[model samples]
Target: MKAEHQNLYQPHKGGTLCKMLFPVLLLTLFFPLGHAQSSMSPEFSIIKPRHSRLLKSALQRETSAFLLSDPWAPLENQGWRSCVESRNGPALPEKSEGYIQVFLDGGLNQQRMGICDAVAVAKILNATLVIPYLEVNPVWKDSSSFEDIYDVDHFIDVLKDDVSIVKELPEEYSWSTREYYATAIRDNRIKVAPVHASANWYLENVLPVLRSYGVAAISPFSHRLSFDNLPMDIQRLRCKVNFQALTFVPHIRTLGDALISRLRYPQDPLKVTAAGDKEMAGKFVVLHLRFDKDMAAHSACDFGGGKAEKLALAKYRQVIWQGRVLNSQFTDEELRSLGRCPMTPEEVGLLLAALGFDNSTRLYLASHKVYGGEARISTLRELFPLMEDKKNLASSEERSQIKGKASLLAAVDYYVGMHSDIFISASPGNMHNAMVGHRTYLNLKTIKPSMALMGQLFLNKNISWSDFQQSVVEGHQNRQGQIRLRKPKQSIYTYPAPDCMCQA
Candidate 1:
């Protein structure tokens, strides 16, 4: 049997198959020859693929007998209700000697994470946050303004008690840009910036700036705050910041409501009768297919589309992403097997299908204009033909309103993902990390990838589809949006646990 087809599992030492199987087989001797031969055919064969020793045992977990969902069914735990009930943020102090205010400026994901940090910093310093300046992502050239996407008025009103916030810098723009101190941008192997200073540094250095200049401007503030050994209250403030403060703007939200309504009744009787479709489809999974051009160029993976493609990606990676990677350091084969970069569409398709998602399963792909367009998408589409995107789901008129606005389109995907039945990501990228916090805050099911384990399995060509699927299924069965109470700063899956979950 081909490795890609069989249900064989890699041999983990001291095989756990029941010894009684042989004895049961003895009874089969009395049966018809046809029945016994059934096991000999390809379908029931137990042969492990060649060249495979057990890579770590696939995530070993028992099947859950009871459903772990709430009464609302798929809307099991929404953030609106779940978060409002959280005591995750510390009680507000009665008095403050002065206020620490900051201006946030970064790319979309950076700004999202920066909001979490800014709220934490505000609580840590007991400062009020000026409405952040949402900078256009230079790389993306998106034109949507912050107010156009998020409700600034609602954002301030909701968090007014926990931390004071204003829309835009309260004073002249020069006050923010001129008399401010900015933290040095930091980076590490994982792209998560390391802590630049201790709490004392904020108290002594950053605080004085607030005192000296009523407003302090913190550029590239995402991932700037560290959770290392901080006081419990400080950590809680971080959660409060992430869950409570960063509400979407009203414009994006109305569209979100429409999307949610569609999900709730995909086959409305009235609409269906008009459109010639009555089949109801609900509960989709979101794939943050982070394989757009920028990502591929940034990673420099170059999965070899002949000589020209390889050289182009190699050169592209060199141009941006700083000096984090170099083409000469790794080969095409090494890059693919090492899992050092994003998975190819074919690879993702194979992975999803092998893990039991039927080809007919509806996958809501949350992505921008994928780099290679339909050609790249067709790779995964062939495997899961029922795939849909914003283009497929929304009307031409609906899409035209946000046409050419990259950030608004992203907002569409973000909101849809937040409400999905299950959210699965390709890697620990921004989309995955942000949703981990967002969905986790809502107690929604998230299939967080264990990259190291996945890489080991993905690279092992000898593993059969059945074995690969079973291992993946068992490995991840326990991680159905289970709370990650405490984890390292770099680990994106548990990123929200510090702020979103309580002891209850």
Candidate 2:
């Protein structure tokens, strides 16, 4: 059986022709070609020609007993409501102190948090905010600006009452650029703002700069503001920015709506009656597969890729971080026991199967490139044959606007994930953190996976499928969309219970 599995994947070496035949061969091996075609929906049936499908039928048969009668039932939200109350907080000052400029660095979600913190910092210092600058992402090499991904006008208009915001600096402060600050440390440049700096820290360090030069430019400003000890109004303003202010541009939203429409009604329009349309409006689960190469390499845990894979990852780690991976000291077993390893595509597929999702579930994959390419994700495709992603669902013309732009693509995924009936991330990261908070704010259902429990379960090679399914179901009982109140030093973006929510 192992040899057959290895043989099934050998087409990847033969290039395009063999890639096209790979899925056909797998379909023939598992189900007859006609049966495969008839069983698949229009969307799944017409995935890119080169896309491959490989299934291990023995594993599927083992876990088929746990399939639920109603796996699409919505998770409840215990009467919690999103409420940003600043009635007792102080009002905005009549006159702004000066201008505050921030250059944010990181991916979409990290920069998103930085943007909110920039707004709060502006409010704290009573300064007018110049639009935060989004640095070019090093990994994706995307040069998309803030306006390219978000609705700038909407962002400005939504926060107009809370804090002052401007698209550009005034003529007097126009000379303040990122290059200017990098060349030399001017009086107005703040290059040393601490991570999670307190409001008082900003007042002392930045307010003086603002008063001295009438402006302050903060570079590398991701996570520069603290989450704790802020005033009630400041915290509420952060919540408002995250939940109400940030909206995607028109094109991204249009594409997102189109994708959502297709996911709900995948059949051809000519075959549909009104009743059939109602019945076919299916609910989808958006699985944010955060299993890219950077994550896999940085985890420093072996993924059964053999010695060559291990050597490649080690070299990658050295090149990326100069071999500073802190988890490298631990053995793979120790790391898995500590829940520090990233889950692979196959592992996450088994997780979904154990959680009662069957082959019929419409799984929308919200991800970038998986590490090992098509061969790596073959098991996941087999587990949920009805799965779809941006590339498969959107036409080349339809997705042209966001094709190579990572930030824009992420924004589209964010929009679609927001509209999904249920959202889950294979492993927790920035995207997962952002979605969990946003879904909680909207009272939508989101499954937070227990990484430690899952790690331990997969380690037990002799465990039965029934026992694994029961453990997963029991472990996740209280984790689905439950409100976790913010503790000291906890991010309001992730745990927005008392700060951003009100109990009914």
Candidate 3:
């Protein structure tokens, strides 16, 4: 195993050891080796043999007698409440302008945002919306449509007053399909809709098409709508779509409920109990561990996986993105300082430890296959032995419905995440963004980690565990479930304040 590990790190023929050492030496010149690892507490040290130098140095730190506080304590919501004021919005037009179709791309969350935008766009155009087409995710290869994941009847029924949504196109427009638009760019197909496009842009571009053909189909409709400058009603409608209209199919919800039940009451493994059974139930924290291989490679940050991991990620980047990753230009230390790097499983585990979460904490690992697999998450598992995920909590037969389907699996996680007593993401991504906004609307406790502070703290070799804990607590004081009003051009989906919330 040692020989294999060494062989994995060996460079091509004629490459000297100095070549590999040069980058490390260069990094040390700016940021010394002393700043790399000593910052972590000894209690959270990883036990892996071939770990990062940062974890290796953690083993050398003096043990501190720090006790876990009641980390499961509920947080107070400052005077704001979720009040989506759509009552004052303009009433939907009795007569529709035409049919509006959107072919949404990306993962479940991205498509979810698109669905909200499509509804908003339909209202903007006074057009009837055909159920938005969910493009097969290229990465997950999931061909699940909108109906497959969401309760379509509920979706239409909830949004009936806000916008007109249909199950499919009219028979007259049956010829208007995804393939029809792909074969040749018809004038009716608005394919060039820019990212975060203003309402006026859609009126100028799409209204004419609706007038001409009685229908318009927008392909690649992910993030094509603007987050700002829209009417208040439009913004509120978007929120309604996200928070109320979009609900998982019955099976996904059932699975999610089952997982939540198991998390709250772990003693009865064979028998899933009701969520209301509080006698033996415990609160669980949903940790959306977003550290996947694609995210790791795209971030272009070193994760202490050594040279072999680096080489493998580089190859992956080349194959997938043609080496066009922008973060590749910066050093790992620079990225960490800027908070551009994704927190590793070990680092996030340490964060949980520093924030008072201990071995007794019930942690739900909400993620797909983590970048390095089980070996990568072994340290985290060691930290929280009672951790659970979909596979572990649900039987293989229970998981069969969502098996091999990324969107359905993600929907399950999303459902479970929404019901978690507390939610914290290892790093920010689509799922994190969705959960943050949804939890905020419901005024639930959601911890948004201060990445820059965490990076700086982690980089400090001399900082003790107590100091680290204080800094973390102080830095995150204002970040927990606080209603941050949406700034100009900021995502309403992520920050649902002022638009989706009303002062109490």
Candidate 4:
């Protein structure tokens, strides 16, 4: 009975040899099946791009051991220091040296403007510029890494000999996460460079690339992160070569140029105009409490405080009304309750009425309805409690001019171009600020900074609305001499605007 169970292999062969041979045959037959069924995890398998040679060393047996065991281990290269050493001087004879590129990763949609200020700075420095779009692919089920989004070889090919690409990781602690994308870039398989996250990352990744290539300094923006505090490196680099920081402002250049072009051609309904002395109908000051619903996530760089709703009435008052304010949740009554001096709707109404063009002045309250900004209609009611009675202020007909977010922002480029005054912007990150500032600068009009600090903390040292007001007046006066007063460096005027269609 036991003999009947085995049969085939043990029936007539050498027992030990048959056992070994059978096991080998079974393994051979099932090996492909096991491999076919196996799958990589979502994070790694998804978004897998075509093979990259650079990626070889990153995942190879020995290098991967180092990566897993000691990601921070120093490589045998001079690091970013060499590249920094190369950029010092007067424009590098335009063609004498290679190109350096600073890549802004995860730059999707309107957020691409963050790189605007930086890109404008780049053109001034003569660096070859490239912006790889990291768009997510819907068809691919797996998570797409940065490698899948951008063509690395194509990116490198565009660069001049000595230059390298530096990825600007989004801020730490802020919810805007771009670390995964940056990691993919660093994980180029071949271990040719160091992978990094910040200036320190640059020292690890960029420095190694340059050192290996025997080049010096990458053309980057202000080296404050790398050498500003460390005088020794700066001094050492200073002696070696022109280790200077170059500003790239292409983003700014394009936006500014687009605004200027539209102004130059009025027939284009899609274009924006410069701020004019005459206010347009519904010329309201639009402030953002929350940029869409994700306000809590992306801290307000323009709102002054980290959170928008918590901004004190005092801080709110600091934003002088250049035009009619569609009502914010921060009403005059609320301001008074908070022990902050309040500006009445009558006062706001009076300012609008007194305006050289009241009927033409349109106020807009733009924010997601969920964020709790008073509706434009109700806001108008508060601004003119007696809209039902003209004796108190402007006639009801006059107050009906304000618009809401959808309508207002749709034609923001227009209002900003034709009628807006120094649009008291909330922050640079907002779509409003990008369009308004870009358009304002294109017309060569004086575009001033927001009264609100870059973040709430930016107001800490400069607290007290009184002091803040004084600073606003004083700062503008100072900048007038710089950004506004100068002969307008044509260099500063050439940033590109975002495709207006995207704004649509």
Model 3 collision count: 0
Q: For model 3, what is the alpha-carbon lDDT of residue 319?
A: 43
TM-score of each: 0.72, 0.86, 0.86, 0.32
Model 4 stretches astray by more than 4 angstroms: 1-130, 135-205, 210-357, 363-370, 373-377, 380-422, 426-504
Give one digit per residue, the lDDT tens place, for model 3 in 1-504: 235335535787777676556445543543345322122223223335323443433333322344333556666757888776587787889899999999988899999999999999999999999999988887778999998999999999999888899999879999999888889869889889999999999999999999999999898789999988888899999999999899889989888888887888787744545555565678899998898877887899887766666765675555445566867888878888999888888888777776667677899998997877776788787678888898889999998999999999999999999999899998988898999999988989899998988888888867766677677767877777888888998899999998888989
Once fitted onto the true fold, the runs of candidate 2 whose alpha carbons sit more than 4 angstroms away are 1-69, 268-280
Taking all chains together, the TM-score of candidate 4 against the true structure is 0.32
| lDDT computed for candidate 2 | 0.80
Order the candidates by TM-score, highest first.
3, 2, 1, 4
Higher-ranked by TM-score: 3 or 4: 3
Candidate 4 lDDT, 306-389, residue by residue in tens:
233333222222222211233444643443334232121222222222211123233333233312222212333433332221
Minimal lDDT window, size 10, model 4: 495-504
TM-score of 1: 0.72
Highest lDDT model number: 3
Estimate, for each residue in 3-66, the C-alpha lDDT of model 1 and write its tens digit: 4212223454565354324324443432234232121222212222212232122112122222
Residue 335 in model 2: shift from native, Å?
Answer: 0.7
Scored by lDDT, model 3 comes in at: 0.81
Residue 286 of model 4 has an lDDT of 29
Q: Which of the two candidates, 1 or 2, achieves a greater lDDT against the reference? A: 2
lDDT of 2 by residue, 10-31 (tens): 6565575775565565545444
**TM-score head-to-head 1 vs 2, winner:** 2
